[model samples]
Target: MALLNFSQPLISDETIAAMADTMRTGWIASGPRVLEFEQALSDTFGGRPTRTLTSATGAMEVALLACDIGLGDEVITSTQSFFSTMNMIVKVGARPVFVDCDLISRAIDLNQVEAAITSRTKAIVPTHFPGALGDMDALYALAQRHGLRVIEDAALVQGSEWKGRPIGSFGDIATFSFHPNKNMTTIEGGAVVVQDEATARRIEVLRFHGIERLEDGTRDVVVASGKYNMSDVSAAIGLAQLRQLPAFLAQRRQLADRYFEKFPQIEGALLPPRGVAGQSWNMFCVLLPFASLGMTRQAFRAALRERGIATGLSYEPSHLSTLGRSLGYREQQFPNAERIGEQTVTIPLHCGMTIEDVDRVCDAIGEVIGSKKH
Candidate 1:
C-alpha cells in the first residue's frame, strides 16, 4: 500500500506546457503573463482589482501597508489561523489582537471579534478556515459599525462564495494562496484583490520595490517596500490552474462528501459541519475525541502510519506558539481554538483523491480507532 499524502497538487500536462512556454519567452520575470493572471482573477471574482504576488504572505503584508495599519494600531484576527495571518500584522508594525474561533466551523467568532475591538482597532483579518466560510455578512457589518478595514485571509478559499458573491468580489480586500497543496497551484504564488483602485495601485507599487512608474516612464518612489512580484513562469502556471479551478473544486467537494459519509462509522470522531452552502472545502478535517480513543493525536498518527496512511493537523493554534507567547498570549486564552488545535486532524483530501481512496482512508481510521477502543 502506498502512503496517501495529506494533499497533492492536480497539475495537468497543459499547465506544464504553459510554464515551458513562459520559460521560452525569455521574459519570465514579472511581465505580461503576471498581468494576465491578475486580470483573469479579477474577471473571475467580479472585476475586483487583483494583483499577483510572490506569496499569500506578501499579499497580506502589502494589504496591511496599503491600509496604513501600523505602529499603535491593533489588527483583530483569529487565534486559530495560520501564523502568517498574525505575523504579517506584527511585520507591519501593528499589534495582533487574538479572537477565538467557533467550535463548529472553526472560523473566527464574530461576537468575540466585535467585543475585541477597541478604539485603536484599525482592521479585522478574518480567516476562512478549511471546510468552512466565516460569517462574512456579520463580520462586514461589524467592521462598518466600528469603521475598520477588512483584509480577509482567504488563503483557503480561492473559489469559495458567500451569500451569492465570490469571496474576494465584495470585500475591502482578500488574499489567496496558490501553494501546491492548496485547491490550485501556481507552483508557489498568491494574489490580493482590493475593492478600490488606490489600494490596488499601492499593492502594485509595494509588491515591486516601491517604484511607481509614470505615464512617460518616469518613476516615483513611494514608501520603502520589498520585492514580492510573481514571475511570469508562476503566472503562466496560475492561468492554467485557474482554467481548471472549477473542476478541481468539484473533485474536492466529491471527496469531502465521501469522507463525510464514511467517517461516521468510527465512533467518537467528530465530522465537519454540514449544510455549509458555499465552502471551498480546501481540507477535510475531523476532530477526534482523544479521551475516548485513549491515545494522543501523535499516537493516532503513528498508528495510521503503521497502516500506510498519513494524516496532518490542519493547524496548531497560532496563539500558543513561541511568538504568540512572546506577545503575551497564553494557553487557554481562547479555549475553543485551543481545543481545535489539539484535536483536529486533516485527512487526505485533494483533486487527485477518488471515492475508493476516501474509503481506504476511512477504513484505516476505523481500524485504528477500533483497535484502541478494544
Candidate 2:
C-alpha cells in the first residue's frame, strides 16, 4: 500500500545549493539574500515594493498595523478561509466583520461585503482562495467607496494573474506565504507587496522591532515591535524557488488538469471551482456531497484512507471556530461558508506527482464512492 501525502514542497538542487551558500556566509539573519529575494519578487510583480517577513501571518499583521487599523476599527473579510485571515484582524484590536463566500469561486462574496461596511470599517482583507483570484476590481472599488484600505491575503496565489496583471501588482497591499506546501516554498516565510515606498518602509520598520535607521547610521527605537524578519538562508531558498516558480506552476497545472479530467467520473464528489484563465492552481480540493451520498465527511475520508490515499480538509470556517464563537459569532451566520467547510477536502497535488498518480487517487476515490452507493 502506497501512502500518498496530500502536499509536498518542490525544492530543487539549485535551491538547496543556494541555502548552503547562505549557510557558509554566516550572515544568515536577514541579510543580502533577503533583500535579493524581495527584489526578485518585486521584479516578478512589475516592480511593486516588497518586503520579506517571517510568515504570511506576520506579514498580515504588519500590513494591518502599517495601515493604522486597530482598536475600534472594523475589517471586513470572508468566513471561508484559514483562521489567520480573521485572526490577524483580531490581533490588531479590530473587529472582523464576516461575509459569506461565493459558492463557485469560494472567494468572499462582494455583494455581501458592500452591505457589511460601516463608518467604523477601516480595511478589507480579502483572501485569494486556493488557486482562485477573488473579485479584486470590485473589492477595490468598494474599498474606495467606503474609504477603506485593502490588504489581500494572497497566501496561495503566488504567480497568479488577473486581467493580464499579476496579483501582487495592482493590489494596495498583497501578502504571500512561502510555507512548505504552498505554490512555492522557503521552508517557512512570507512577503508583502505594497504599491508605494512609504508603505513599504513602514512595513520594514514595523516588521523588525520598529527600528528606524536615521541618516549617519544612527538607529532609533520607534515603537518596540516584535522581531519578524526572514533569515537569509530561507530567502536564498525562496530566490531559487522564485526562479523555478514557472516550471512548478506548469507541473501543478498538468496534475490539476488530470484531476479535473478524472474526478468528474466519480459520483458524489464535486471538484472545486474551476480556475479562471491566468489564475494559479495551488491545491486541488474537492467537495464531497456527503448528504447526497449518505455519508459523513469523516466516513468519506476514512474510506479513502483505507486504500492508502490520504486526504486533507483545506479549512474549517473561521466563524465557527473557538475564537469565532468566543467573539459572538453564531452558527449558520455564514451558511455557504459553513457548508463548504464541512464538505471540502484536499487530495494529493504536488510538483512531484505524475499523471498516473492522479489516476491512482481518482480511481481510489471512485472505488470508495462506488462502494458507498452499494
The lDDT values for all models are 0.88, 0.87
Candidate 2 residue spans exceeding 4 A from truth: 264-268
Error of 1 at 123 (Å): 0.3
Q: What's the CA error at residue 78 for candidate 1, in Å?
A: 0.4
Instruction: Estimate, for each residue in 1-374, the C-alpha lDDT of model 2 and write its tens digit.
Output: 77888888877889899999999997989989998999999999899999999899999999999999889999999888789988999998999998898765788888898889898989888888655677778888888888889999999888888898989998699999999989999998999999899999999899988999989898999676778899999999999998889999898888888888887465556676665688777888887788888888898888888888788887788988889888899888888788779888899998878899899988988887788879
Predicted model with the maximum lDDT: 1
Candidate 2 lDDT trough over 10 residues, lowest sum: 264-273
For residue 35, model 1's alpha carbon misses the true position, in angstroms, by 1.0
Q: What C-alpha root-mean-square deviation, in Å, does candidate 1 show against the real structure? A: 1.3
Residue lDDT tens for model 1, 1-374:
78888888988999999999999989999999999999999998899889999889999999999999999999999998888998999999999999898886888889898889899999999888756687778888899999999999989888888887888999699999999989888878899999888888888899989998989989988589999999999999999999999999888888888888887475656777775777787888888889777888899899888888788887788888899888999987899888888899988998877899999989988888888777
TM-scores, all candidates, are: 0.97, 0.97
